[model samples]
Target: MSLRAYLHAIARCPSLEQLWETHTQRMAEYGFDRLIYGFTRYRTSTSLGDPEDFVILTNHSREYTDEFLHGGLYFHAPMVHWALAHDGACSWAVLHDMTRERAMTPEEERVVEFNRRMGVHAGYTVSFKSISNRSKGAIALTAKPGMSQGQVDAVWAEHGSDIQLMNEIAHLKILTLPYSTPSRALTPRQREALEWVGDGKTMQDIAVLMGLTSATVEKHLRLARDALAVETTAQAVLKASFANQMFVMDV
Candidate 1:
């Protein structure tokens, strides 16, 4: 597909799943068979916030992500560090250079070794620009197995600009879609209660609007807080709003 057509499709994606499906397929055409995109708004000076709060989408097999992500290997990943510090495309050759120079820390070396075992040797990492100091987003495009970094670099030299642009567009569209980890997800009733609270409604008022007793209204708000892992209803509203999960049209 043409670049223009791909961008248009992503811009109109009604849900995250559809957008991700379209993006992964398009990227595979460029020889990047595995893609992992991650975004976090809860970044701190020392950390990228909690893993549960991140927006992570990947086409990699569970065998890879299960350890890289769930096992916290991403924290020690060299490209992840580079992505956090830079705002553009970088070749994995940089990591190779670092290895040659013995500049990688022990933890980082372990991550590199792990990737090598996973057949994740060749790829490019694109670190997306962030407007907020506490937010970061990036995508890693891994080439098909047995493809050397030199071969991947050759493809990048020819079409790097178009590839980066498509990824940036896909990342922007992803941010507009509502996303919540399963544990953070709210039920329809919980969301409606929070929406009312956002509008400054009292418990009784929300109860009347939701056709429930004040006790049930309070119950929904309490459950919302638990789901969002917030201490109060106001915090839940803010968290949900940040994730674009509040007052959103059903998709």
Candidate 2:
């Protein structure tokens, strides 16, 4: 299907299942059979335990899905780790180049073996954090061999932004659904710090901007991270942006 047609189908989706169907249909049009869209909350915990949060939408074989989840493959998936470190969408070629020299852990090797068995030869992964300063996760699209790079790039370049936007919308919708986790509350100072961070300011820069000691700035950031249940200052910034928790003030 054409990109415009695929986007129209996505636009018509009224539920998560419909969104998955649209995405899978689009992927099949491009010659891919397996697709996995996942969200995780790893930044909040020291150990990558069972995702305290999730929003997986997939069209992969049930056997593979069952094996992946049963084996807890996410903890060792190199793609997941790489996606967590970068911003925006990335292709499989980029991932291959990035990890070429790094030795894969045993667990990571197991994930690779699982991928090989499942016929997933190449894929792209995109990540986003909450606007409320709370959580972060990723979405992945996989394809079998024989799919040309041009084909992949063309589709991604045309549809990538919409996919990211949809993921964010879906995330927010899921969060606000009945029985979802309560939203985290932030103090005025914490809110200010989060906004500055999203603006790409460093702690030192924020301290100078706020006319406060670096230590005091750090203290506020620490509190914000704790309240948001994030591990790093970067995660805190992303979560706040995703959750729309940061209040922008005119200087």
Candidate 3:
């Protein structure tokens, strides 16, 4: 597809699943068969916040992600560190230079070795621009196995501008979509109860609006807090709002 057509499609994507599906397919055309996109709104000086609160989308194999993400390898990844510190695209050649100079710490070197074992040899990482100091988003584009950094660079030279534009648009569109962790999605009832609470409704008021007993309404609010991993209903409302999961129109 032409760049213009792709950008239009991305802008019109109503759901995160559709956007991620099209994006992974589009990126694979450029020999980047594996992609991991991560965004966090709760970043702190010492951490990226809880992994459960992050928006993580990827097309990489389960084995790769299980280790890289679930095993805590991402914390020490060289490219991940680069993305945390800067914005815009970066070639993996810098990682190679670091390896040659023996500049990587032991933890970083271990991450590189794991990537090599997994055939994630060459790629690019795009760190998206953020207006808030506590927000960061980035995508790692891993070249197909056996492709060299030189070859990926050549492709970038010809089409990098369009690729970067598409990624940026995808990131922005994703932010507008309602997202909850796989195990933490609120039911329609739970969401409705939270919406009422957010509007400063009392339990009896929400019960009247939802046509449920006050006990049921309170139960829903409690479940919403549990789903969002917040201690209070107010915190649940805030977290849901941050995830775009509150007061969202049906898609």
Candidate 4:
């Protein structure tokens, strides 16, 4: 695809599948056979928010992701730490420089080793721009096998600006789409009940407004809480709001 068409397609993607496929294909054409883009707005000092809440789009195999992401190896990854601490694109050459300078921690070394074993040895990482302290997003672009870091660097030297622009736009487009953990999505009744509760309605008042009995409204509220995995209705309301599922104008 031409650069403009690729940019437009990514921005208008209606779902994650289309976005992932298009972006993955575009990156592959640039010799990065693997790509992973992760986004989160719930970062804290001790955590990058819940894993389920992260908008992670990847073309890597389940075997690699399962080991690196679900196996909790992501926390100790050097590049991940670097991304958290800084912004803009960085080459994996930094990792080698750190190794040569003996600046990498033992944990960082282990992550690098694990990645090497998985053929994830070379590429670049771009930590997307964050508008707030609580938000963070990044992408790891992995070079195809047999491609050395030096060669990847050469490719980037010529097309780095275009690569950065594409990723930046993709990241912004993803933020405009809907995202929710599977179990976190509430049913329509559950959502409506929570919306009213969020707007300052009591259970009995909501029952009257919805033409349901008080017990029915209470049931919906309880289900909403369960679906959101929150112990209290107030927490449920806040979480739903964070997920952008509250106060939406119904069509």
Highest TM-score: which candidate? 1
| Over 4 Å off, model 4 | 198-205, 246-251
Q: Which stretches of candidate 2 lie over 4 Å from their true place?
A: 1-12, 41-43, 148-251
lDDT of 1 by residue, 1-251 (tens): 88989998999999999999999999998899999999999999999988888999999999999999999999999999999999999999999999999999999999999999999999999999999999999999999987999999999999999999999999999988999999999999999999999999988899899999999999988999999988998899988998999989865
Arranged by TM-score, best first: 1, 3, 4, 2
lDDT of candidates 1 onward, in order: 0.95, 0.66, 0.93, 0.87
Give the per-residue lDDT digits (tens) of candidate 3, residues 176-206. 9998887779999998999898899988899
Cα RMSD for predicted model 4? 2.2
Positional deviation of 204 in candidate 2, in angstroms?
A: 52
lDDT of 2 by residue, 1-251 (tens): 66567566666555556666666665665555576766554445465433433546677777887878656787678788776666567776654554586567778777877876777657677766645233466667776567754677777777667656655554455443211124456777888887888888988999999999889999999998887688999988766654446663332
On TM-score, who's better, 1 or 2? 1
Query: How many residue pairs clash per model?
Result: 0, 10, 0, 0
Clashing residue pairs, candidate 3?
none
Query: Which candidate would rank higher by lDDT, 2 or 3?
Result: 3
Is 3 or 4 the stronger prediction by TM-score?
A: 3
